[model samples]
Target: MAIDWIGFSYAATLALGGVLGYTRKGSIVSLIAGLFFGALAGYGAYCVTCDPRDVKISLYAAFILATVMGIRYRRSRKLMPAGMIAFLSVVMILRLILSLL
Candidate 1:
């Protein structure tokens, strides 16, 4: 199978979210659950798109996740968890918008 950069990046983003969640909450369960869901969603999105053209769903999810994380970070005053998610979410949103154009 061909390698999908976007998919890989998405997966990485999910894994990062898990890491950040663990660091912020000190809950291994959060990390594992996040990774599991993220990986699943990333792989699913990757397969569904087969390219950058169909990034809407992924983009929407990314945007939402980012927004939520940003808010979470603001409230908790934590940098790593929320910051990382927000950052990646922004990147994904940008990519999605670009893909649309």
Candidate 2:
């Protein structure tokens, strides 16, 4: 089975982001969220590696992240964490959709 490099990278990024959030801001919530979503994404990647057609988990994770982060970006008007993650989530969604086509 081929590895889903992009998916894995995205998962890593999310996990790292969470760690950073906790280290920098001491936000337990961020840590939990980051790890939870990261694990979800990683599992999704594993599913995709086994069968490219299986994108349900990955898509749901990305959609949830994008929606939540997008809202945070809108309210905070900051581009560091929320905006960047939201943008990445959107791009990931697009990539996942394209892979299906």
lDDT of each prediction vs. the true structure?
0.72, 0.97
lDDT (10s digit) by residue, model 2, range 31-89: 99999999999999999999999999999999999999999999999997999999999
Best by TM-score: 2
Which candidate ranks first by lDDT, i.e. highest?
A: 2
- lDDT: worst 10-residue window of model 1: 1-10
| TM-score, per-candidate, Cα-based | 0.71, 0.98
What would the TM-score be for candidate 1 when compared with the true structure? 0.71
lDDT of 1 by residue, 8-90 (tens): 67777687777776998798976995787587658647864676566656766776778888998889887766777778778
Residue 88 deviation, candidate 1, in Å? 1.1
Q: Kindly report which residue pairs in candidate 1 clash with one another.
A: none
Per-candidate total of colliding backbone pairs: 0, 0
Runs off by more than 4 Å, candidate 2: none
* Candidate 2 positional error at 96, Å: 0.6
